[model samples]
Target: MGFFEKYLTLWVALCILVGVTLGYFFPDGFQFLGQIQIAQINLPVAVLVWLMIIPMLIKIDLKALSGVSKFARGMGVTLFINWAVKPFSMALLAWFFIGYLFRPYLPQDQIESYIAGLIILAAAPCTAMVFVWSNLMDGEPHFTLSQVALNDVIMIFTFAPLVGLLLGLSSITVPWDTLFLSVIIYIVIPLVIANSWRSLVLKQKDGDEKLTDLINKITPYSLSALLLTLVLLFGFQGIQIVTKPIIILLLSIPILIQVIFNSG
Candidate 1:
């Protein structure tokens, strides 16, 4: 297993804590970085986002895309889990807990924003990172890629509808522009770049074990960039992030359940 795969949650926790610390201590620096925006996207995090995605692009073999139909079952399972099952289940959990169970514990003003964030997260399936999860589970990579690609494609169609449906319940302002930009930058561009670069390089060279070695060497660079980006995201939104406790608690249950179930 890759280093990140072996201790993924731990690394994420570390990154979150580091980001919160940085944001807390150097609040001005975080604000300065946040202000550097292009196309209305934060520039520093955008660069870090590039780092996060570029490595995944390098690993995608174009041949996998061509071979998608060969692994229909896996694709179906992925689609079912991501769309049919996960989203509804999360909605149920959020309703039961946020709207009822812990409603008394949560602040009334932030309840809508908390629910909105959860809905946003639910609508978006894991991209660039799910491959790692799939591989660790001894999944078929071709099928996994095909599955992820299908989800990405479907996301373009479903994300807005689902988010609108769920977030509408709480009456939150849906940021359509931010959502679309996120899909373009984080999903579409990275997918295109990774596939094209890997395909072109392999077509010219042998794409042999040596090339694989080269890729493995550089893979961590992109991961480092991703981790850095997450750090900055949490850092910028530090103290304000803790305002909603119930939604955080609710999110943990489903995620925790998924991790254990997937692992088994």
Candidate 2:
């Protein structure tokens, strides 16, 4: 692993701190950046997501996508975990930690809201970041792409109903625009651009060598964009983090448990 990858945890910690501090001191700037959104998706973060995933996507050979059928078992397991396990498990963790164990410390009125937030978070599987993670693990690129695409499709049908079921609500408002716009921005556009660029690069005389060199050159930018994204994310929540440290910490316990459990 390279230095950046080797110390990614440390770098992430530092970025969180930097983001929080900057946000607290210069709230206006971060708020301005935050407001640049459409369908509740932040444009700056969307751009960074594009930078983060495009290099990994470029490495994917769309022609090899037909071979993804060989991993049907793995895909089935992923879907099972994502749809059948994650949301309910997260709701259970939220009930334990936020709704029960830490009840005395939390505002009774907001307990339901907190649990709902965790359920919503867990119900939606990640999309763009899957590529970055798969790249870091040196995983199968085609499988990762296919898996993310499948998850997105399943999420479209299942997210609102699942969340409504877990939250005990009769009907939940699903942001249809956000869902479709996110797919277009994160998957469709990036895939098209990356494959087009890959094809163009492969037409050169020293095609393979040039492509390899180009990917190497752009990989750092991808990682850098990831770090920047972390900064922006933390920055957006800096005020709540600073003012309600204990509440934030307590809320994080269920989320942390949910992530570890689902990922495991």
Candidate that would win on TM-score: 2
Residue ranges of candidate 1 with Cα displaced over 4 Å? 1-9, 37-43, 131-141, 167-180, 199-209, 241-264
lDDT of 1 at 103: 72
Report the lDDT tens digits of candidate 1 across residue range 1-264: 777768877987899989888887778988989999755678677666666656655666666577778677767877887887767766766677666776787778876665666657777787756654443465555666567667877887777677777666534444657656766776677668777777766776566665587667766776577678779988887755665444566656655664465445
Worst 10 residues of 2 by lDDT: 254-263
Global lDDT scores for all candidate models: 0.69, 0.92
lDDT of 1 at 1: 71
Clashes of 1: 1
lDDT of 2 by residue, 36-111 (tens): 9999999999999999999899999899999999999999999999988998899899999998999999988999
